[model samples]
Target: MAERDGGLLLFLTGAGISAESGIPTFRGPEGYWRVGSVNYRPQELATFQAFSRMPDVVWGWYLYRRGVCRHASPNAAHLAIVRAEERLGDRFHLVTQNVDGLHLRAGSSLARTYAIHGMIDFFRCARECTAETYPIPDALPLDWAKDRLPTPEERARLRCPRCGADGRPHVLFFDEYYDEPRFHCESAQRKALEASALVVVGTTGLTNLPMRIGAIAAQRRIPVHVVDLEPNPFVEFAEVTGGEFLRGPAGSLVPELVERLVG
Candidate 1:
C-alpha cells in the first residue's frame, strides 16, 4: 500500500493516533475522567449544549485537552505521514479527526490536510457572530494553575467573542454542523475521490456521509488501504488492509507506511 504514490493518499486519522504521546483518548487509562467510572464518555464536555449553556465546563475540558496537546509532541507516526506527504507532494491529504493542531505543529506543509474535528489553537466568535475573534496561536492564560481552578474572570470571558454567546472550545461537537467550506474546506475530497490511490488511518470510520465518497472511489476501482488497531468499517471500502486494523499504534505503524511509500 505504501509503494503506491504520485496519486492521492488520503490519510484519515483519529484519537488513537495521538494516544502514543501519552495523551488520554477521551476514555483514558481508567476510562472516563469523571467520578464513579473511569470510562468517561465525552457527553457534555463535547456538545453544542455544553458549549452554549455550560461554557465553563466545556472550555475547562478544552483547557485540559489544550494543555495536553500543547505539551504533547507529534509522534513518529505523525512525522512519517509528513515524510510520506513530502514523497507524494500534492498527492496526499492528511485528514484528521483530532482538533488539536499537532500535524500542523509537526511541520506538515501539505495544504490538503483537513481537520474534521476543528482546532484548539484558534478560537472563534462563538456563533460566527463577528468576522474576528482573538486568535491565540502560541500560548494560554499566564496562570494555568489558577485558571484550572475555574477563576471567576476566566468563567465570564470564556463566552464567545463572535456572537456574544458563551465561548467554548473550537472543537466540533457531535450535534454541530460544519459550514462545509471550513470543515471539508475545499475541493480536496472531490479530487481525492478521483484519486488513483486512497489511504485511511486510525479512524473508526463513523464520520460524515462516506457512502457517496466511498462509492466514488469504488466506482473508479482506486486502490484503497486501511491502517488501524482494529478493523474499520471503512476497510470494506478498501481493496486491502495493509497494516493491522487493531494492532500497532499509529506511532509504530505510520513510519513503516511512510518508508514503504518513500521507498
Candidate 2:
C-alpha cells in the first residue's frame, strides 16, 4: 500500500505508551466515574447512552481527562517514535489507540500518525451538523476541576462552531463503531497488512480492530515485535510466530528499538 523503498514499519501504540508520561491507563480506579450515588466504569461512562442521559456529567468527566492529558508531557517512547518518523520518512506509520496527542506533541508528523481513538484536544457537533472537528475553546480552562460542571458561558462556548448545536468530544465513544474518516480504522488495518514489520507497544490487544491487525500479521508470518513490561497476547503472538519479544518498560525499550531500526 506504500511506495517506500525500504518497506513500511508500522507501530501500534496504546495507553501504555502514555502511562510513563503520567497519564492514567484508564484500566483501574482512575477509569471510574461517580454521578450522584451511581458509579460507572469507563466502558459505561464512555458511551453515547451515558452522554445522552447526562451530558453535563459526561462533559465534566471528559474535561477532567483532557486536563490530565494536557498537563502530562510526552515520555521517551513518544519522542523515540518521532525520531523514528524523521529517519524512516515515508517508510514509517504510527497507529495509536491513545487520544492524548502526545505523539504529535513530541514532533511526530500528524500526516503519518493515525489516532484511531480520536483526540482530546478537539470536538465535533453532537448533532453531526458538520463533519469537521474544531479545537476545544481556549477559554475553557485546561485544568478543569473534577465534578465541576461548565458555567453558562463555558457551556455556550462548547456549542458547535458551525451550527450552534451541542458539541461532543472528538473521541470515539464506546457505543460508537469506528469508521474510515473519523478513526482511520480501515487505513490502519490496511497498513498493518502491508507493513514489513509490526511493532506492538504497550497495548494488550483487547480491542477488536487492533487485535485483528496483530492476528492477521502474525498469521501471515510477518515480523512481529512486542515491547511491554509484562506478558500479554501480543507477546504470545510474537513468540508463536518466531518474532521478537522485548520485555521492559516502553520508555527505555522503544528508544533502543527505534535506534536499531533507523541505524
Candidate 3:
C-alpha cells in the first residue's frame, strides 16, 4: 500500500547506526572508562546516584563521548533515514535511542524525530528548579579526557542559570524512568499505535521504550521489520510478529530498505 493511504511508517534507531559513524556502542569495550583511579561501566556511571555523588566524573564521561561524536560524521544509514523523512514527510517518524544528534545533523527535522535517550550536547538543572534545557557551555571543551575532573572554572560554568545548582546532562540515566517531558514516552507509545509498520535498526531491544514500542506494534499485528548484522530480540520481534529480519550491516541494508519502502 502507498504511504498516502494514511499509514504511518515508524523508524526506531539505536547506537548501532552511530557505531557506523565511528562512535562506540554503550555495551562495547569503550563503555568501560576510568573515574579518577577507579574503573566504571556505563551502567554504573550513568545513573542519578553517580551524578549526585560525583557530578564532575559523570560530566567528564559525557564530554568525552561528545568529543567522540564530534569527530565522527553521519554515515550512510543516517543520510538514508533523512532521505526517507524527506520523501515521506509527516507519514514518517523516527524514534532514535542515539544521543549523538547525528540524525538532526544529517537533516532529519527535529519536529519529526524523537530522541528518547536525550541529546548529548544539552544539559538541565539537576535540582529541577526549572524545566529549561540548555546547550553545553561554550567554555567547556567538547572532548574531555578520561578520568579527568572538572576544573574550578569549568565547574562554575556547569552551574544552572536558574538556581546556581549543578547542571545535569540531559541524558536519561540508567536509574531514571522515562517520562513525557524529557523522553516523550507517551507520545512514542501513541505513535506506535498509529503506525502501520515499525522498522527497527541496529538495536538489540535492550531498552524499555523501544521494546515497548515494538511490543505495542506486535500486539497490533502490524508489519515489524528489523535490520542488523546479527540476530537479536528485534529480529525475533519481526519474525514472531509476521515480519522479516533483514540481516546485514545498517549502512548498506538501511538505505536499501528505505528505498524499497518509499520508492
Candidate 4:
C-alpha cells in the first residue's frame, strides 16, 4: 500500500487518533465545533480578551476538556505511532491536529511532534503583560451551563500567575488564528514535510487544516498513508479500514501498523 505513495511519511491526524482513549473527536452536528448549544464560539472562547473578561466561561470549558484528556492515556495505536517513528527516526513526522497532548505523553518528542491548535499545557495573561505563558495547577471544569460569562468583578479574580493578568486556555478556537500559523507552526510543518513520509490517521478529511495537509502532501508529492475504522469524507488517497484500530477499548491498532512496518 505504501508503494502507491512516493516516500515521505507524515501522519496528519485529528480527534480520531485520540478517540481510542475516550477522547471525543470533533464531528458534525454533535461535534465539538458545532454551534447553537451554548457552546461558546471557538475563537471567542480561545481569545485572551474573552478569557480575561469571561474567565469562568472559558476556563470552565477548558477545565472540562482537561478532565477528559487527563485520563486519556495513550493506547497501543498511539504508542505504535511512537514506536514506528523510533524505528524510522528522522524519516517519520507525526503532525497532529489534536490538543490533548497524548502524542507527547506517549513519548513523542517536542522536536518530533507538531500541534497546530496549541496544547492545554500553559496559561498566559490576557494582557500578555509578561513574555511567559505560565504553568498552573490543573483545575476541574466548573459547571457553567447555568452561569453566563462572569461579571467584571468575577473577571478580576482569575489572574495569571506569571503577570497577574487574566488568562485563557491555549487551544485554538474558531475565528482565532491557528497557533501554528501564528507561532511558527507552518515552518515546523514545512520542516516535517521536507523530504519526509506522511501517514494520515483517524482524520475526517472534512477539516480545513488537516485536509490542507493532504493537499500539501499531494502538491509536494510526499508519500501518504491513511488508516481509519470507517470511510472518511476527508481522504481518498490512502488505505481504508472498516474495523476500529484500537482493540476492544483497551488495546490499539497502531501497534499493528508498527508490526506492518517492522516485520
Candidate 5:
C-alpha cells in the first residue's frame, strides 16, 4: 500500500531496538542490581526513592549504563528510522521509550524525536531549582566499574551548577509521572491522535504511555503495525487495530519496512 497521504507516521521504539546495538536490556537478568549485597531489581534501582536513599549508588549504576550507551553504535534499525525521517520530513515523528540516545546518535533530529523516558547522558537538578538538564561532561569516567560507589569527588562533580543540590540522571524513574515539558507524554498522545499510522518496534506494551499511544491509534482507526522478535501483547494489539504484525528482530524488519514505505 502507498504511504498515507498527509498525516504523520509515528515510530515508537523501546529497549529491544537498542539491545541489537549491544546494549543490555535493562529488564533482563543482566539488569539485576548486585552492588555489594544490596541486591535490588531493575525496577527497584530505577526509582527516585532509590536515588534519594543512595545517590552515590544510583549514580554509579547509571554511570555504568552511560558507558555502555557511549560505547555502542547505532544499529541498522536506528539508521533506518533516520532515513525515514529524511524522506518523510514533517510527516515523520519518533517517540522512543529508550534513554540510550541511540536515535539521536543515528541522526534523528531532536526537534522531531521525543525521548519520553529521558536520556542517560543528561543530568538535572534534584531540587528542580532550574529547568535545565545539562549533559554530563565527557571528561568524567563512563567506564567506572559497578562494583564500587562513586568517590566523593566524583559525586561532587555531578552536583548541579545552579544550586548546591545533587544532580540526578534526567530520566523518568519508575516512581515519576510523565509530564509534557519533561517526558512529552501529552505531546506524544497528540501526535498519536494526528497520525495516520503507527509503527511500534521492540516494545512489549508493558509501559503505560506506550499502551496509551497504541490505544489512541486503535480507537482512531489508525493502522498500527508491530515489529518484534517474539509474539507479545503488541501482536494482538496489531490484530485488533487492523494492522500487520511482522515477527522478527527490528534490526532486520524495520529497514525493510522503511524501504517499502518510502519507495
Candidate 6:
C-alpha cells in the first residue's frame, strides 16, 4: 500500500549483488566443496537430505560459507539499495535471493527487506520445535578451510539451546519448499503484485519466485528495469514491460540508476 510517484517500488536482488563484494555464486565453480575425496556441488550439499545424512558435513559447509560472507563487506550496489530505501521510505520493498545478509548489513530495515532465501548467520532447531532463529556468534572462526567436518566439541556447541536438538543453518535448502513464515515467499508475492516498478539487480530469473515477479509486473504493465553484467532472459521481459535493460555490473549500474531515479 505504500506509494512512490504513483506506485510502489520493489527491488529484487540475487547473488550477482553480493558477487561484487567478492562472494562467489552458489552455482559457480567456486561453490563446489570437497569433503574427504568426494566433491559436492552447492545443489547437492544444500539440501534436506544432505543435512539428514550428515549434519556435521552440512553444518561445516554452511560454517565455511558463513565465514566467507562475514569476511566480505557490502559493496556499492548494496549501499545504493539503502539509499533508494531512504528516498522511497515505506514505498520501497526489497526481496533478495542472496542469503549473505549484505542488504541488512548495508542498513536496509528488516521490516521492508524480505530475505526469501533466509539468512546464513542464523540457526534454527533441526526438529522445528519452535520458529525461533538464533543468531550465530561472531566469535566463530572466519577461516574454517582446514576442517570441513565440525569437531565433536563444535557439534556440541551447535546444539539448539531450547530443544537440545541439532542446530541447522536458517537457509532455504534447494529441496525445501518456500513458505511465508520461513522464507517470506507470500510477502514477496504480495509486494510484486502491488509494485508499480520492479528493479531487478544481478539476477537471471532462474528461480520460480523471481520469474513470477517479472510475469506479474509484465501483466500489470509495470516497468521492470534489469541490471546485470551480461544479457539475460530478463531482458526480454523488461522490454515487454516497457523497461530498459542496463547491461553492466550491478555495483556501477545500480548506483547510477538510483541517483537518476531519486535525484
lDDT of 5 by residue, 121-235 (tens): 9998999897688899776787766655778887788889998798999999989998887788899999998888899999888889999999888888877889988877767
Model 2 earns a TM-score of 0.94
| CA lDDT of each prediction against the hidden true structure | 0.63, 0.86, 0.86, 0.60, 0.87, 0.86
- State which candidate, 3 or 4, has the greater TM-score: 3
Worst 10-residue lDDT window for candidate 3 reads 1-10
Q: Write the per-residue lDDT of candidate 4 for residues 1-263, one digit (tens) a residue.
A: 33233344566667777887888753332233322366654545556666556567776556556656766798777887777677666666777778888889998877777777767765556665753544434332333232234445544545677677666665666546644433346754575457444566777765466676666665665445556777665345432321123322223555665566543
State every prediction's TM-score relative to the real structure: 0.79, 0.94, 0.94, 0.72, 0.95, 0.94
TM-score of 1: 0.79
Residue-level error in angstroms, candidate 5, position 251: 1.1
Per-residue error (Å), model 5, residue 71: 1.1
List residue ranges in candidate 5 displaced over 4 A.
1-4
- RMSD of every candidate to native, in Å, equals 4.1, 2.2, 1.6, 5.7, 1.6, 1.9
**Candidate 6 error regions (>4 Å):** 1-6
Candidate 3 per-residue lDDT, tens place, 89-113, comes to: 8889999999998999999998999
Deviating ranges (above 4 Å) for candidate 4: 1-8, 26-53, 129-132, 138-158, 179-183, 239-252
- Structure candidate 6, residue pairs in collision: none
| Candidates 1 and 4, the one with greater lDDT | 1
Give the residue spans of candidate 3 off by over 4 A. 1-4
Question: Which candidate comes out best when scored by lDDT?
Answer: 5
Residue-level lDDT for 4 in candidate 6: 31
lDDT score of residue 223 within candidate 1 = 61
